[model samples]
Target: MITMKEIARRANVSSATVSRVLNNSGYVSDDVRKRIMKIIEETGYIPSEHAKALRTKQSNVIGVILPKLSTETSSRLVNGISEELAKHGYQILLANTNLDPEKEIENLKLLKSKQVDGIILLATNRGQELVSEIQKLSIPFVATGQVIEGVPSVINNNFQAAKDITSHLIEKGHQKIAFIGVDEADWEVGHRRKEGYLAALKENQLRIVDEWIQKGIFSIESGYTSMKKILESGNERPTAVVCVTDRLAIGAMEYLGEIGLSIPNDIALTGMGASDLSKYVVPRLTTIDLLSETTGAEAAKTLLEIIKEGNTSDKKVIDYRLIIRDSI
Candidate 1:
């Protein structure tokens, strides 16, 4: 590797002069600075980020903790975050948990130890253990998805989104509508969405069927299973279904298809997340768009605000829009 000493010798300047030019500190003649910069560009000399971090106490990097990198929502969110952070000369170090809740806390500690200038957590569950660990972080931190009290977060109005989608089904005259959701442990996707669905039903004065409300995991297979259980529960078939996620809705749609059911004609369907699949599916799915990429962008923006300005808003709420497609 060509060292600064070599560049100094080539430029006919002392090492101190080269150092001053690299750091942009003290003084260096404009001609000499330009010459050194040209040499750096020609040689493709990369500065030691580690050395800079130690000297300035800034990593110029942020750590991002996400649940599963494979999901469409997760990938879009990361893209949004990377795009916004890049504008501010910040790079992201990613830690994917593959949906394991424990890994969220572990990555938190790990990122802290790496001396990241800040952290953006793509939170899944708002568990006490995870919140406690987050509270202990010493660096600028922001989260997206689930909310954490007193901690800045970027979130979608899951409850309101759910209520609106359910109400949409109601407006289409779907009084007997089934709901497919995940475990309530996922406060935002599960508990909050269920609450919204229930609220919409109660507002419309529709009877709630216990068996029509099904809980499943975050998988298409789980969605299929939940839909199957709902149908076989010996209750009258619902006119429509509201799934908390597109994957779940897809699975349910598949199941309905296998049973010779035609969408909208047989049963209307609505999903959340507005994944690409939702737009291309047969009959196209009427779904809720969480604007996931915007959520990620806001999370990174909030963290940078905290790191650079020593201040940030408590929360940023990204509005969810009801996308009208043919499925509903």
Candidate 2:
């Protein structure tokens, strides 16, 4: 029978390194990790969970709380998290909130009741109530997409990315640009994104029409309504429009079509979030790639570190890119 010690011997690493690779406790370079894993697979060696359970008292399950399961963003996040967690022999207990903030709190406690080793929240709104509930958790925890005070998180650069994309429209001679965003409850997506757009205009010394800035929920229909509002705002029509999300942008596009407005000809449009639909749309969307998968992977890795080593970074920022496509 293949033993861990023998596996270590074959892999030319200490048993502790093999243990780290199996236990997901310590850092092992990807090269060494792959080599050890390959040997384990060839030898058909399975570590005894009974011993691991006794030593660590861990359930080997991670609880993931998501705002909504149906969205492309949520799906990509889950794929990244699951891929990373699976490397360490951990499974996910998914908790879908369906975009309700209150459900986030409820799922936190529910995951705790399930005796999950750790919890990760794909946060939507960082309300005080939700933050307070998270603070009460004794187990390892991580948040993605939104930062909570003193909590470890992996988030996209909403502010800078938003500003840069807005600046792109400006560089294309779009001084009369409009913005469609969400409510301020979602601090990062709502407030930070809006602030970034506003900052870009300020830097370029441009004036914004009062009616150009509109707010809506995270929905396609809401986006349609918001864009309708922007166009009918006044005699001064914006040459371009920026929507906070791809879903919103798609909705806006539908509205533009209904009114027989040609994209980038009648009015240029931009959106954040590089969703799948963005690529295949009538006019490919010019949007920001938020690296949703990376966000999930980073949060999962951090949560594992917290659970195993009791040490982790308080915050990690994910990267994003502005994708210029046919729409803009």
Winning model by TM-score: 1
Residue 15, candidate 2: alpha-carbon lDDT: 93
TM-score of each: 0.94, 0.85
Model 1 weakest 10-residue run by lDDT: 47-56
What are the per-residue Cα lDDT tens digits for candidate 1 across 12-96? Answer: 9998888788777888989999999999888888778887788668889999998988899999999999999999889999999
Candidate 2 lDDT tens digits, 7-105: 999999999999889888879999999999999999999988666665668878899999888989999999999999999989999999998888999
Shift of residue 111 alpha carbon in model 2, Å: 0.2
lDDT per model vs. reference = 0.91, 0.91
lDDT of 1 at 207: 91
Q: Give candidate 2's TM-score.
A: 0.85
- Candidate 2 Cα RMSD (Å): 6.4
In model 1, state the lDDT of residue 165. 95
Instruction: Report the error of model 2 at residue 173, Å.
Output: 0.9
